[model samples]
Target: MAWALLLLGGLFEVGFTTCLRFVDGFRNVPWTIGFLVSVTLSMGLLEVASRSIPMGTAYAVWGGIGALGTVLVGIWWFGEPGTPVRILLILALVACIAGLKLTAGH
Candidate 1:
């Protein structure tokens, strides 16, 4: 359950970060609201995840998933850079996240 919360937190982290790009320097009201809500929820979920997971491992996984998801969304939806090198880096991050999860041992 805590791992699930951690993954949810990672998803929300991606949401808030992606929304930040749409905020237009904090001028877009709707995006701003989404940013705030997503950030709040992400942090809350992280807190819950911390109860059962080591802080270092949990935070690494959280950040790794958020970064990977945000970059993938940017590439797929926003026409951001999708060079092969960049894609490989993203894959590497995913691998690291998976390694952390596999070794976390609940």
Candidate 2:
């Protein structure tokens, strides 16, 4: 349950970041609101999930998910480059995230 919450929180982190890209320095009201809401939910979920999970492990996993998701969103939604090297690095990051989960013991 804690891991689930943490993963969900990480997804919210990606939401907030993607919203931020459209926020236009907070001048865009709707996107700004989206960013705020997502950030709130992400942090709240992270806090709750950290109750049972080790803080270090939880934070790393959350951050990894956020980074991975954001990068994918960038490529898919923003037409960002998806070069082979970049994809390989992203895959390595995924492996590292999995390794952390496997070793976290929770």
Candidate 3:
């Protein structure tokens, strides 16, 4: 359950970060609202997940997922650079997150 919450939190983190790009320096009201809502919901879920997971592990997984998802979204949706090294780095981070989760046994 906590892991599910953490994953959901990470998803929200990706949503908020992507919305931030659309905010156009905070000029777009609707995108800004979306960003704010995403941030709030992400943080709330993270807090809940923290109850059962260690802070370091949970935060690393959360941030790792968010970073990886955001980068993929940027590449596929926004035409951002998708260098091989960048992809490998993201993969490594994801592996680390999975290792931590698996080792934690929760």
Q: Stretches of candidate 3 above 4 Å error? A: none
**lDDT digits (tens) for residues 21-105 of candidate 2:** 8899899999999999999999999999999999999999999999999999999999999999989999999999999889988
Error in Å for residue 94 of model 2: 0.7
Superposed by TM-score, candidate 3 places the C-alpha of residue 23 at a distance from the truth, in angstroms, of: 1.4
Q: Candidate 1 or 2, higher TM-score?
A: 2
Off by over 4 Å in 1: none
Give all TM-scores, in the order shown: 0.94, 0.97, 0.94
- What's the residue-level lDDT of 37 in candidate 2? 97
Evaluated with lDDT, which candidate comes out highest?
Answer: 2
- For 78-104, candidate 1 gives per-residue lDDT tens digits of 999999999899989989999999998
Off by over 4 Å in 2: none
lDDT of 3: 0.93
Local distance difference test scores for all models? 0.94, 0.96, 0.93
Model 3 over residues 16-56: C-alpha lDDT tens digits?
99999999999999999999999999999999999999988
Using TM-score as the measure, the top candidate is 2
> Candidate 1's error at 69, in angstroms?
0.5
